[model samples]
Each structure stands twice: as structure tokens, then as C-alpha cells.
Target: MARTHTPRSHLSVLHTSASRFASSPAFYVPQTLSESGDVASWKPISYIQFLHDVELFARHWAHVLKLDGIPRRSVIGMWLSGMTYVDVLHIYGLSRAGYIPQLFSIRLPNPDVVYELLSRANACALLVDPSFEGLLKSCPIPTHRAATTVYDIDSHDMPLPSLPTLRERDTVFIFHTSGSTSGIPKLVPCSSSWLDSAITKSHQIAMPSGRTKRNQDVTVWMGSMCHIAQTFMLLGSLQHGACTVQPSRQAFSSNELSLMIRDCGVNRLNQFATFLAQHLRNSRQNPRLLALLQTLDDALYSGLALPREEEEWAHGNGIRLRNLFGSTECGAMLLSTRGPEMFLQPLDGMSYAFVPVASQSEAGTSQGGHSAPLLELVILAESPDCPDNSLRAADGHFHTGDLFQEIRTGCYLSKGRDDDWIKSENSLRCDTKAIEDNIRATCCDLVAECVVVGNGRPSPALFIETNSDLPQPKLKREVLRRTRQFHSRRYLHERIASADMIVIVEKGSLPRTATKGNVRRRVTEEAFRTVLDKIYGTEWTGTT
Candidate 1:
């Protein structure tokens, strides 16, 4: 079949696809999860049915929310805590009704932050999943306690309204940052042009080199539906006539995910690094799960760096792990190709540049312990799909605040956040993310979490939360050995001098950001102030 010309806007593309593939399956919904976490059966939702549901919800919201005569592009807040296919449908439904759906993250547990974001977006109204209505008793906006489940029941026939005319620069969706590094999450508006580019670029890069076909028969999305990446992928997949499977429960177990992968015949998988690590660990004990994972055509991860040992293990076991790099501000930018180091392959239709970062240490050493200058990624404003101007700096480019190191010409490795660079008292700069990733990867089996501190102190200290049941003495010995192993190839100032510098805490004790559950390094450092004082109080002299 020859490809159809791409539509001018995101909703137009969906409208076209629904008309063309009316009977084709757009989603495979798990009917039920048995006690053992097995999927009993799958229910396919066709393109026409999905479009019909969207239309129904659009009309219903228009009536109940009194959206009649509302101005186009009015902001509407949506928080569907336990995400489902219905929530995704409502996003389109809201957009079709000439409103922008501003999504709130389920991972962000604090209602105050959500309220702040809602006020910041100037949302006209807020709609929440019925299950989470209790959370926002004091919400300032006009809160509507509703559920898409009402539309699930039988509905009277209604005439479909004409597609609203939307420009390329029109805001279609709104997402926010996790605020893992920054304090409060900021609203990121996605333009129609941005969504269109994402859909087109995703289809272009869907196929690998050796793959004979470009069809994504069944793709399982394992991340939060509120995540921008998942949202982009969902739109892209539907436009390409692919079937997607998502989790039914708020929190799905590994067994449930594995069952979905096996039963749904999933070829492509998109998951976070933490969940991937858990699956990898579980696969070690279950060969059947390992075999299922190896059968996947494409395995992708983002949000955080995958541990080195796990990446090696996946590739060794024939799982083609691909790293996806993108942000809420910018749609998908790069997809890593097969290589020794995960060198990024830039996607088409996006304009991005790298600005050189200053040398870190007195020796003029850059990040990654190499002479190559570390580069900060800048998303050029000239890109065809450039979204809103909120993040654009005075230079007319959105500085992503992400740092990368070039390993080869035109290929780079993501080093960590440029703002996360820590300077020790000896004037040597330490890459905190690098050290944390290394320690976590090296001692993955024993450590639940790791954070490096001591910004202006003698040396960086290692704080780890133990995940193992081994005795403290034995665990400390093993941890020290691994720490030494990690320090073997490092420069002098980057190493944690003695075993005394290693502080072990109880599991689940580290402070995490309310948004994405990422460890709040500054907050954690403050929480362990006494321990840090004790460690740094003594004459912790090291050769500098």
C-alpha cells in the first residue's frame, strides 16, 4: 500500500487514520488480570470505535463542563491517576472539543505542586479520575469529579462534529517536567507541528537496519501514560495502524508485564530503566521470561541511564536494548543505534546543536575523564516542530541543561545534567551522576539507591541504600570492595578515600522528588547532615 500524505495537524492525522483503518485494531485491552497476574484475555478496540469514544466524550464534556462558546485552546486540567485507555482517549476528546489537555503526573503525589501547576497553566477547569477525587479536596479551580467510565456504558447516537481547524503552532497538549533537578515542575506545551513531526519521525525510525518490515504489530508501553514520550509514541503508533498494550492497574507487577508481553505478541517494548532492571533481574530466575524478552524486535528505555552491567547483560542475552533520548520540551530527538557505546542517532526533522561546556578541573580535563570538551545540548528554535517559547532562552534556543560527551565524530554519550556537576574543595569537579551510576551498576545486587555528595568538602562521599539482606559487616566489606573496583580507573580526587566515607542507609530511606520518584540529591544531603558532618568532621585527609 502506498503511503498517504501526512495530515497538516495531529488531530487531522488521527481523523484520517480512523477513516482509512476503521476496522483495524488500535489497542489490545487486557480484559482481566487473574490472581497470579496473568492476563485472562485481550479485547481489541478498533480505530473507528476509539474515534467514536472520543467523539462521545467530547460531546459529553462540552455539555457537562458547559464548554459551549468557550474560546479555542482554552486550558483544561486532567489528572487520571491510575491511567487507562480511557484517559488517553479523553486527551484526544478534550483536544477535539477545542481545549488543551494539561496533564498532571501520577508520580507527583503532592497536591500542592499540582495546584501550583494548575494555576500556572491558568486552566479553566480540572477533571480528575474518580479514584483520585479525594486527593484534591482543597483544589482552587472548578473541579469536576468525573470518570470516562460513564462513556463506556451504552450511549445514544450523536452526529460527529467537523474537525476543528488548528494551526501548526496551536497547542494540542501540555506536559510538565519531573522537577527532579529543578524545584517546581514547569508546564511544557506541545504544538500541533511538534506532534505531527513526532508521528512522522517515529514511523521513519521504526524499522532497524536488518528488519524486513516497518510494521509495529504489537507494542507494549510500560511507562506512565502521563509521560510525554509515551504520549508521543501512542499517537505515532495509532497513526501507523499499530496495536498498543498498556497496564490496567496503577502499579503492575513484573509477572503481569511478562504475561502481557507473552500473550499480546508484543514486538516492541518501551519501559523505564528501573523497570527494565527489575525485569532483567527477574529474568535471571525465569528462563521463559528471558526467552520472551530475547524475542522482542526492539527494546527501548529512557528517563534515566541504564546501568552498564545491565546493558551488557541484555545485549549478551540477545536483547537489543536501545536508548531513547528526548525531553518534554522537545519531542523525540535521538535514538541510539547498535554500537560499542550507545552513540546517539539523530532523528529527522529536528534541529539541535551542542554548545561546548567549560573544562571541569585545573588539569583542563572534561567530563568522562577524556580531553574532549563536554557539550550542552541546545534545541534550536529554528526547528520546524519547535513548540512554545517558554523554555527558549534569550539566544532564541532552548538550552536542555543536559550534558553529553563525544566518544566519536558525530556520536555522543549522555554524561549527566550540566547543573549536577559538583566541585570539591580541592577544585576538582566530579560528575555526580557518573559516580552514582557506576556505583549502582557495580553493586546493583546489593544497593537499592546511591547518591554522591560533598560539593564543597574535601572529597565526594558515597551514600547507598542497601537492597540486600546480608549482614552489615559483610555487606560493608563487599560494598567497599566494589567501591574500590569502581575507583580503580578514576582520577585521585574523584575517589572516595576510605571505607569510612561509605554510609549505608536503610532501604526506602532516601528522599525522592514528588514528581518522578528520583532521589533529591540536595534534600538527601540535608537529611544526612549529621552523618555527613561525622564523616567530614574527622581529619579525612586524602592525597590531592
Candidate 2:
């Protein structure tokens, strides 16, 4: 297929989803565990009430934005703590009033990064949640205020503020890049039509074959309102009349998660693969939850491919975990595979190819038959939801920043991120995926994550995390065992680097994307700079 700039657009999502599924149930929020630490009963908010909430919020939200000098189509920054039905309402209200909603995760500890996003978006004012009020005060920006929460779902007859007219092509959403690779944040603007398509695409790509039992199945949204993935999942559930399940603000204990699965009958989940791993592990501990998993319709995940072990675990447990590929800039998922298929050869309608980097010399592209040259994965699609202003190559293809090797017709295997490609002074290259894979497999039980760093050095260094309980002696021994195993691979040969340089960090010390669980490579390098300095005898300039 040839690349083309033209894409058919759709109507605004906010005003139409309810009418499209007028008979569907709205959303389901399990009350937070009470003071006594008991799970609360499930409550369902109807579409009627949802619309009323949107209307009420839009009218008043618009007034507040206007008073703060925010005009129609202004980008509004949101510092979100927890995702709720109200946050969903906030997006719709902002869109309805012609204010574009952009989210900055409160999970990120850096106030400077959050402030930079507000500055980049030229946000009129930052609307922060009450829980994030203290965090917002330090973020130097134009101005900030606490946004209204949806305390009551039942609509009151408060004088409705009139909604400003919005356009289908209007930029209604501005989501920041995960920035796990780079600690700094950049914005991805989403138009109303883009979200409109995402709402429908979520169904087409994610819905189980021949099943539309509206309000019967529930979809768990694991991302916060500020994260890009959450908005689509919320709207997608509402469109299908499927109940949207809210994850606990804090990580759910294995027992609590089990109860939610049993009680909520959560058959579908759209979240990072890491969270799913915890659920899968917990299900093994709880028979009822395992039974629930056995009957799951589908599980959609992004962030990174599930560790091969986790993917195998899902299949052995009788679950079909699918992979979703997209970025905030792509608007929504540009490519998705059904079930647990791991290969990413593009299906028809989307054209993908491996190409040499734009700056790579002609010598780099000249390859002998014995070995294949390293190339970047690029995509050319007719997705109208994405604006043309997004990062793109001069040729118009969206360079996904992923690396892959086309093994055969319509099949390709992932090689970590292109930025993770490492080249030593001797020109010997090592794949980050291979290292991470070995480390993960070796420390599968004790390690929560494994990051291979040393893009430009003689050998790679491993930064791993695990539960704080593991004795330092045991942790060191296990990591050393893994390091030995990693180097034992003759395929990597002498390219293998330092194993004794392993750093065992406490949990949560490594920077992670709030929703995606992706390790911020650059951020982690900087965060653990002191440790790396002590080990390497100088500053650690993290690999790109």
C-alpha cells in the first residue's frame, strides 16, 4: 500500500457515544476499601446520570476555565492522582466546552518535568486533583487550581452553563509521551475525531468475536486519566455499554484483586503487561480468580511485550493475552494482534517496512547475504485521527523507534528499542532484549525488573529491582548466577560485558511510567548515577 496523507474523519465522541448505546449501563466503580478495610459494594452509574455529569461539569468547567483566562480550544493541563468515572467526565466536559484535556501523571516525582509539560502546552491553567494539590503548588506555571470532583453522580438542576461549540477536527486531547526513555515530557495532541475512532477501534480490535453483551462484561482501565490509554478504554467501554472497572488507587493486594475479579466478573482488561503479570501470579494463589481467568474473553496490553515467561503463563492459565502497538502520537493503536501471537509482521491495510536510519551511511545499508543489516521499523497508515504535526520522517512514515528483523513473509521478531541498540568501540553490537531476557529469566522469581545498560561501552551493566525483603547476600548471589548464565551464551561471545557490576536497587527507586511500567532508561541512569559512579569510577553517561 502506498502512503497517503488523506484520512476520513469522524464526529465528536462525547455527544454521540451515549446516543449510540442509549440502552447501555454507564460505568462501575467499586468503592475504595472503607476505614474498617472492607471492600464496598459495586455501584453503577447510568448513561442518563453520565450525561448529566458531563453537562454539569462542562458548564461549570467552562466557566472556571474562562475565568482563568482559558479560551475555547485552549490546552488544559491535568495533574491526576487516581482515575475515576469523574476523570472521564472531566475529559468530556473539557471537550464539550472546547478545552483540550492534557494529562501529566502524578506518579512522576519530578515537579520540573510536570511544569515543563504545562509550559510546552502553553496550558492556560493546571487543573489538579485534591490529592495532588501540594504537588501542584511547587510546579511553577502560569497558574494552578484544584478542579471540582464529581462528588454526586445524580445531576442537580444547577443553572447549566452553556457549552461552547466544538469541531470534529478540534484537538480535544493532549497526552504526554511516557518519557520513560527520556525523563523529559513531550505532548501528543489528539483530535475529537481521533478519539472518536479510538472508541470504535477499541471494540473492533479488542471485542471478542460475536459478543456484544452490553453491560454484562467489564473492562478494567489501569491507566490514570492523565495517561493516553485510559481515555480510550473508558470511552470504548461506554460505547459498548460494557462496565468500566476502576482499579484501586493503590496497588491491589492479591486477595483484594481476586475479590474484584470474582465479584466484578472482569473478563476483559486493558493495561500494561506487568500489572497483568501480578494478576496472573495472584490467580495462581487464588482458585476462584484462576477460574475467572480461565473464562476471560481477551486481554489487551502495551508498554512492552510481556516477558516470555508471563506470556507463557497466560496461555497455560487458559487466557489469551494480545499485544497492542501504538504511541500517543499515533492517536490510538496503529497495529494489534489477536490472542497471544508474538510476531509483529504487519497485516494488510497497514504498510510496514524495515529501513536504514536516515543518517546511516550507504555502507551501512550495503549488506552481505550472510547477515542482515540493522534497520528501524517504520509505518505508513491512513489514520485520520492523528494530526500531521506529530513527529514523522521526511518520507511521512512514523518511525516507531522499535527495532525488528523480518524473518519471513508477514512475520518479524522484536529486538528492543532502536535507542537500546548498543555498539562497542570494536563495533561489536549487543541486543538489549537478549540481555534483559536472560536477566529476567535468571532472576524471574526475585527480580521485578531487569534493565541492560551499556550502549557504548565494552560490556553491559545490569540494574535490577526486587522486593526489599530479599537478603542482600541471596540477591547478590542470584544476580551473579544470572550474570554468569548471561555471559555463558556463546552467541553473544566476547561482546558480553560486566556481570560483577550488577546493582540491586530497592523497589520504586527506578523511575517507571505511571501506567506502562516501562523503565525510564535515561532517568534510571541518572537516578542511580551515584551508584554507577562508585562502580565505574566516574559519571555514568547512560546509553541512548
Among all candidates shown, the one with the greatest TM-score: 1
RMSD of every candidate to native, in Å, equals 11.9, 12.1
Each candidate's TM vs. the true structure?
0.73, 0.68
The residue ranges of model 1 lying beyond 4 angstroms of the native Cα positions read: 1-7, 36-38, 67-71, 148-158, 180-183, 207-216, 249-251, 362-370, 421-544
Put down candidate 1 lDDT per residue, 1-544, tens digits, no spaces.
Answer: 9974433655676788899888888888778767766566778888898887788877766655553344556898888652567877777777776788898755555566678788888888888876677788788878776565634533334444457766667777888764322235568887777777777776665544345364446777654556576776776676677788866552356677677777776777776565566677778889988998887777887655665777888888988788887777776777787744678866776788878877543123333566766788887888755657887898888887777767666787776665665544422345678778767778899998988886545567888888899887787778778766555434344666587778888778889877778887767767777788688783212111
Candidate 2, residue 327: Cα displacement in angstroms equals: 2.0
Look at candidate 2 and tell me the lDDT of residue 324: 64
> How many clashing pairs does model 1 include?
0
Error of 1 at 437 (Å): 24
Position 44, candidate 2: lDDT: 70
